[model samples]
Target chain A: MTAIAQQRKPGAEAATTRTRGASSGAAGGGRYATYLLPAAILFIVVIAVPLALNVYTSFTNWTGVGPRQWAGLANYRQLVHDSEFWASMWHSLALVAAMAVIPTVIGLLVAAALFDVIAKRFGPRLASVLRACIYLPQVLPIIVAAIVWGWILDPQYGALNVGLRDAGLGFLAHDLLGDPHTALLTVMAVLVWFQLGYPVVIFMAALQRTDPALTEAAEIDGATWGQRLRLVIVPQIRPEIYVVLLTCTVASLRAFGWIYALTSGGPGEATQVPSYYSYQSFFTNLDVGYGSAIATVMTVIIVAVSVVFLWAQRRHAL
Target chain B: MSAVLTRRRPARGKLARHGLAKHRGPAAWLVLAALAVLTAAVLFPFALIALNAFKPPAQYSAHGPLSFPDGFSTGGVSTFWQTADFGRALWNSVLISGCVCVLAVLLSILNAYALGIGRVKGRTWILGAFLVANFLPQEGLVYPLYDMAKAAGLYDTPLAVIIIFTVIQGAFGTYLLSSVLSTFPPELLEAARMDGAGRARILWRVVVPVSMPTIGVLLVFFFIWTWNEFFLPLVFLVSNSNQTVPVALGTLQGQHIMNPLTTSGAALLGVFPTIIFFLIFQRTLTRGVTVGAVK
Candidate 1:
């Protein structure tokens, strides 16, 4: 009986091995195609098909309902002289710059203090609560945030002006969204406020992972807090910093929903980002070919910015 | 007790050597205060929105921005519910987001499993493709998608929104899950194989159970993202009944801008589900964002 059991065990093992080998071989050869098929089909049908069509449509002068006349590079050429497009792109850059600088600097400091100083007492609980509160805006649909902000910044009977008058600071209260001068700034402020929590959380998380012993050693060697921070903590989380910068840049460039909801790219196209401009060209103007050109330019800009940022990250790593 | 004393002595010695103990005192408080202020800055706007929701439309504009509503009223809430297609929009949102969450999670799991565990060629390229696709702005493809959806007779349908969202979302979903899967120890997978489990059985019995937390996190994230999506739905669903909450809210805002009462009421109604969802998944969402941070 013992001999028979031993033989049965080996036989079962061999069978399993054979099956595993066969299956793994098959999976190695064609499993990606099988597993990837659903996503691929969906991407092709939905994303790729549209992307291809967009490229084709960009070359042609096609309204939403008409036969296409090949415009070749006219759409692209027109975009060069399209002052509105250039202005919107400039506005987008300003927004990205504003978002990156303020949030990153504040977030880093807050994260450092949270981790290094306040970590001993109410750190974990406070971190969680603060995180939730900060991420609250992320969950609110952009329209609600924009509209509520609109009311708060309303020139007439707006909350901001009302409070400002009461405090004898009424001079600072402009019709923020209505004035072309302040419209971009107001929109950027709202964007920054909405996005502040995410970076804070990200920074906090990255800060926690920073090695305490390194900071302690630097301290023991008489390095000041600021010096230690510059040398040790910043270098350690460079990758995270890069990620935050890239994400913030992308987000600011794609600043559509709030701009749409708040100003509708108005106060005379002052707050018009490329995204809103593209949407206007496509749906409002019903100029498919021109819209496609605008969108393609937007895509190229995003891709270029991302590539540059990534390259900078790699350069920093080296 | 001995270990605690030893640790304390060293920390005290270090502080004394640096003469930094006094400086640390106010610095810590300063840090705390700054964090508190930042937190308040973020929370106050949402508070304004919440406060306004409970007030009468006239009173909301009449009162100080920070003032409490004159009286809490379900009048606006009830009116929002009855007059608008809020209910149907909410149902459509729930259905579409739920379907997207399920489809994305399932498809991502298979792709992640194969890429993370199975010996597959071109895995790096596949991942790179997904990353590039994810980073491509949605506007780049919107017109083409609109044209294609129209050609296939899918324009103005919920399915059109679902398919577009699923594909766009899946790219990122796959990337996140694949990273999570790569962290799963290979030893356990090998052990499961040695224990006579087949690939399907291993996935079901071991991989799924082990990766539950990640799966949960992805579900909530995907659901929230899909639920909050506006532009795609706005472009695709032209029919009033097919309008999701965000699109409906946008339309409502345009139509009722002159009527602050209905507009504020609708805005309040539109944001309710999202707030409720956040509260429900607060724990998971927090953990999900901070997961790779510490470890």
Candidate 2:
């Protein structure tokens, strides 16, 4: 049976080659091969090679120096017992929750308000200016944003505390970054502020694509504003919702720079996300094998979540 | 009869419009007010930075919070250049960012074409791989790549920065460009083929020309990401001479522990190029991200 299947594949290949040749006339398959070479080289050298090396390193006892020895499942087993790794994983998940849910909710409200309320009164120029202002943080370097926020959130001499005292809201003014309990929340707030613009922009674009005629029709039918929104707007921008969710999820998982710049996983590992944990293992601890294992797991989680998202998207399309 | 009919019609129209217009009244103003409040919240820190950047060091230190600058001077700017290697750092940033943009754009265009137009087998798999690769955060591979760069003798060189930037950046570029490429009209490519054009000819003539807007978007996005990259350069580029602006600014902050004014000066200088670039290409940059998002 296997031999028969192989024989049948050869006949299919011959037919395909004949058709392909006839279609191309005289240029042959070489042109396509040539066109694909540069891309193939780039993919291999930059992407494929590094990825393969990483996977290999994950299975070894390499300390980023000296000879790498194959250790198979040991690294994976160790990761299962690593409390810091688990803590970091939870921290990362918490960050993702904050990053995904808050910005999305706020962005939806803002976008909905912009379309239903602001669009009529505000000129387009003003609307554009508002958008630019919101997106400024996103365009600025993350380090810069982190630094600016650091100054604002500084404990003693910071502007935020100064203003709070001036307004007699001193109780609200604590050491936001320096405190272990508040560090993660403060970082989350900064993340939400910086990322709010992304969802706003996407939601606005999606909202604009929604048919105003349908909305008008709904309005004319004596539907309340809430009913019109539920019946007309949300359904139209569903794909943008998925896109925002996926992008935010990934962004949250990859949180590093701001954490590095502001907290450095300080106050006793309070803000240590998985990415930072991975960095610590490799750089600070000189434990490459363990770090690679953590990284491999993260890669798997990211890929798995992304696959689920794309599947959902496909299901929605169907 | 005509006058009576006109008066009744106008009154009915006004009565009918009143409800919709009334619904739009207070709630809309409330949104504007809320937005004004949010804008103020967001703008306060940025305002502080700008205000401090202009003030003299003594005034900045001595003045009360939110106080106006005593006087404006270019002393900070001159001091930044003199005290720090601001010139070299700025040059290094521009060079690295420019090269990364060119390399990432070129690779992405080719890869996007292959995935989009070439009818390649496993195109979806390739795309999936790239997406997964993108999610592998920078810290994960930094050490390994650093070791590899050292082994290959590219460490502490601009080549090291360029290579690392191009490699990591290509992931997003591929994602953005492929999405853009997928939107190109298939009929146009079919027409090109029907005219006896080869794949290369079709790509160069039809696919590229039609995809310029997306390409422009990718260039700006890639440039921004490359310019803003910190971790890879921090780990890979060991020498001070090879330090990019962000790293240099970080170094200055660390070294100049006492003088908050000097640190601010350095930070201002470091951010100047990006501000200028943003001002100049603000329209394209805004449109690019929006286009990427919308699509």
Give the whole-model CA lDDT for all candidates, comma-separated.
0.77, 0.75
Cα lDDT, model 2, residue A203: 86
B95-190: candidate 2 lDDT, tens digit per residue: 999999998888788778766545355667777777777766665566667877888899889898897677667767777787677556656866
TM-score between candidate 1 and the true structure: 0.88
**Candidate 1 Cα errors over 4 Å, as ranges:** A1-27, A121-123, A167-172, A310-318, B1-24, B61-64, B195-197, B256-258, B292-295
Fnat score for model 1: 0.55
TM-score (chain B) of candidate 2: 0.86
lDDT (Cα) of model 1: 0.77
Backbone clash tally (model 2): 0
In terms of lDDT, the poorest run of 10 residues in model 1 chain B is B255-264
lDDT by residue (tens digit), candidate 1, A74-149: 9989989988888888988888877777778877876776666666444567766766787788788777677667
DockQ value for model 2: 0.29
Best by TM-score: 1
